[model samples]
Target chain A: MSDVSSRDRKQSWFYTDIVKEHFFHPKNFMDRDVATDEYDATGKVGSPACGDELRVWLKVDPGSERIREFRWKTFGCGSAIASTSVASVMVTENGGMTLEEARALKPMDIMNRLGGLPARKFHCSVLCDKALRDAINDFYRRAGRFDRIVVEASRVVDLVAKVTDHDIEEAVLEGAHTLEAVQQKTKVGIGNPGVLPAVEDLIRFYREKYFG
Target chain B: MATRHVYLDHAAAAPLDSRVLRSMRPFLEGAGGNPSSFHGDGKEAKDALDDARTRIASLIHARPDEILFTSGGTESDNLAVLGYARANKANGCHLVTSAFEHPAVLESVGHLEKKEGFTATYVSPGRDGIVSADDAIAAVRPDTVLVSVMLANNEIGTIQPVADIGKRLKKLREAGHTKAVLHTDACQGAGAMELDVEKLRVELLTINGGKIYGPKGIGALYAKRGVKLQPLQFGGTQERGIRPGTENVAGAVGLATALEISSEIREAENARLIALRDTLIGGLLARVPKSRLNGHATLRLPNNANLSFLDMEGEALLLYLDAAGIEASTGSACTSAALEPSHVILSLGLPYEVAHGSLRFSLGRATTEADVDYVLDTLPPLVQKLRAISPVRVDEKYYV
Candidate 1:
């Protein structure tokens, strides 16, 4: 108790040293607004309404198929900021990773590099990788590599609302744990009894996948 | 460590006053008898407890016996809501409270509704963050046993129209339209606003020691004379059987001293802090782009400045401010264990983005012009830095 009080008085760090380092001084971060033409392709995920949003700008070398420059901007908590910062480093370190290698980089790798994030903050790590994948897809789309572009698997859950299983999963990741909560967030399966089972299954899957 | 440390999270907790500590030292040291005992030592302890109770009661213009001490604000709120509603269940089972009440009150009402077979109505505040008294009173049915609206909001710092609701409830009772009793959680308003219970016309009022520069873990609930409350605990016969357990003599003395000091200095201190609060609020709005205040312009507490910066999360801004030696708080979900933004900010009909980006800086006795100036100088750059990295645009169309 005494040790805790003394540390508090001294202003102890709220996160791990690595997280603090990255959050205080992020790497490969775009600190100023840049012209859209500067980067080859940009990927965006999440929304400010969801309490977190990430955007990554990637310049991939066409010949080597390596990511030449990786820049990101995030509006999120400490964990999100630190996770994106380290993910940027992981993708761009040592002459950068090839397109396939970058695509293979996972949230777990970023979490491991940052030592570990708080349990509740695990979802924050998922965002940067998703944004990075979006950027990768953007690269493919811009290059006219239509066949190479990967689309996330999702099924429509609410026909009227156009809500999908992926939307339910994202809602769960944003702290809507119950079916009703997910519906409140994404309006999934509302007034449509047929898709309740699928919505519930997706909610349970994402809750266990990220939380358990 | 940063060279300048400006503590602005006073609404969360304040540093204990030296005078209060001095008043509490005797009870903490040599005077160790329980107020429940009948021996001489116990008599001395009981005297201290009674004196504290009287002082606390006088602060709110209530009878000495009406002040019931508890562990803190949460417990006091729990006892008032749960105890009162349970005891008065025979009269009615319906409850009414504002949507933005502290979880202590909200959870108790929720428990009554879910676990018990009671119904409740939650009245939301206006865009100005003020709970309308007419709306609250309109929700009070004949079966409504209790109507609770906080004296001031903890997050946005908007001073609620609790007194207006109290007066309306009194009129309803007189007209035999409803049996609902009014309660106000004055935890955030004790030191900054008038506490005369008669003027407020509230049957129950909760005040916490921690927010008033006293020792933590001590609070008092002012129950009107003849108000019936079923005890939440049954360990002892203390607090007239409303709140059981041996009295916290040291805490009681500390709270009394702190309340007395606050009452004496409230006027001058409020004048001083209001200047700092306005400067902080006005300077931030002028310096930062796309920033807006959260609570009512002039109806908020004298020491509160809650603002939302467009296009960035509050937790990130709070961290940067902390790194710059400016301690503060936020309404952002990331700062909360439940991963939900402040209900108070959301109650004002704000969008999730605005709620997530809200920041609160509550001034206190220790705040000064220099501290305010330091924060004014340090915060604009941090907001700019965060905004540069944020994907959301600052344009008005974005919010639309």
Candidate 2:
């Protein structure tokens, strides 16, 4: 276990050099002591007990609602830290993303930018987009427009396979008819027995509404 | 930054002792014939193997014939658990193990439960990461055939009451209540604690080379006389056909020499490590707020200093420490490939966040007072910087 890492200088067991770089020298990371009044919107996703927690704060131009600056703080592993760091930089680069555009940011987009995370650590990337959406929702929440909040459910459907409800839904929509078919596609509920009922329910709903 | 690297991850892998290397030189540079062959070179190799076995046996106070050599700690643990359990299935079909055993033991027992139809129970350790003798005894049933507990944990370094459990099991065995064999993975115990097999009362014990100051790819299982163990592999009749492969004479020699040396200086080295360990723990707890030790205060390995700095990821701390010329670990080196927090840490009733934030700094023979002082000086600011950037917050400071 311990001697495995000394083999190649280019790669560690779980992280690439780029991922390590972002983890150690993250960009657009805010000091933990930053004032609450410094940002127009803030979002938080995950909990400390879950082993990954991320908070994103945004400075948005009022008329344009364009994110001028983005800063994040993460209480998580290397992937979570690097993913959020890349997300913070991604949103603010090249004249910044609009609030809607930032809200639409996906975890894969951040993972792709960070070069990629290990298969087991792919769930860490989910924190960044969830936190970004949380920040966007926070912006809308603060402006008395609660209806504009884009609900992004980051609840894991399979902790082992790194599957989510969104992934199961995507699999169901792609014409995976049976539980086995959906499981084969997404691997959701394969290792996690507790998520089976929810996965089965989602499969039934999607199958009846779309294929019935 | 210092040019000399301070290695604090001895529990993961210790640097090989020069003496051990010297002991293996003749075997390595010579003919290196197969121990099973009948030629003169083979006889020389066979003699070397026998001598090494005798030396290793003396380290644990076991007979030479009882020690079965294997690939490493993983193989030895696997052989002890799977080999013994499968061989004695008629005695009973139940097995017991702690939840915090190395994956070698945990996974081997898990396989038995899942595929082999053997019933098993995982005894959870207490908050101090110590598996009490009573807890282990409570899990024992009339049909319980085997109970595999570690001598000392690899991650948190909590020294288990293996001998106490063994004593209780011995009573149960004598009373005809159960026919369970007591096994202890003493890989981490070799250099840090006593490995007297009779004193520990363990029927089967596992020890490895790399954890001590020896070569890698070599380990031994001490199966007490009359303890039945089936072959895990089938090939040449090496290691009494239980391990079933041509033995590495050089590796065996190195392991034996290392074990002999480690056993010889264990007490003094343990004393030195304990001082350095306590100083490191005290410094970190005093300087870093919201930090706490992971395992039992006094019952832990003298070389182990496992501490969790709240509000910071252990991987982050490890990287920063590496850049600062200090090498350490977050938890079990085996499980670090996954993002999930250490199961060993979580088994202590700690929350997942606390497990994720834990870091292990195990001292070794090469560790010096200056090294401890350097870490005491380097860690606080790094922790403060990480804490400043951390989103998670805690109010009260924690200590062991």
Best by TM-score: 1
Give the per-residue lDDT digits (tens) of candidate 1, residues B1-400. 6889999888888899999999999899975998878899899999999999988888889999989999999998998999999999977999999998988899999999999988999999998889888899899998999998999888778998888888889999999998889889999999999899999999999999998999999999999988899899898788887788888999999999999999999999999988889999999999988888997988999988999988888888888888888888888766665456677777778777887888889899999999999998999998888887777775674333
Q: For residues A1-212, could you state the per-residue lDDT of candidate 2 as single tens digits?
A: 22222222223346777787887788888875777777898887666655566788899998998999998888765667778888878899899999888877887788888787765456444477767776888898888898888654666666544566777777788777777667545545432457788889888887887788
Taking the tens digit of each residue's C-alpha lDDT, what string does model 2 give over B1-400? Answer: 4465888888888899999999999999988988889999999999999999998888788899999888999999999999999899989999999999998999899899999999998999999999989989999999899999999999888999999999999999999999998999988888888899989999999999999999999998999989888888898788887888889899999999998898889888888888989999999999988899998889999999899888887777777788788988874221254434688887887765677678888889989999999999999998887777788885453333
Q: lDDT for model 2, on a 0 to 1 scale?
A: 0.81
Off by over 4 Å in 2: A1-21, A32-38, A116-119, A152-163, A168-212, B1-4, B332-335, B395-400
Off by over 4 Å in 1: A1-13, A32-38, A153-212, B397-400
Question: Against the hidden true structure, what lDDT does model 1 obtain?
Answer: 0.84
Q: How high is the TM-score of chain A in each model?
A: 0.72, 0.70
lDDT of 1 at A207: 91
Query: Which 10 residues in a row give candidate 2 chain B its minimum summed lDDT?
Result: B331-340
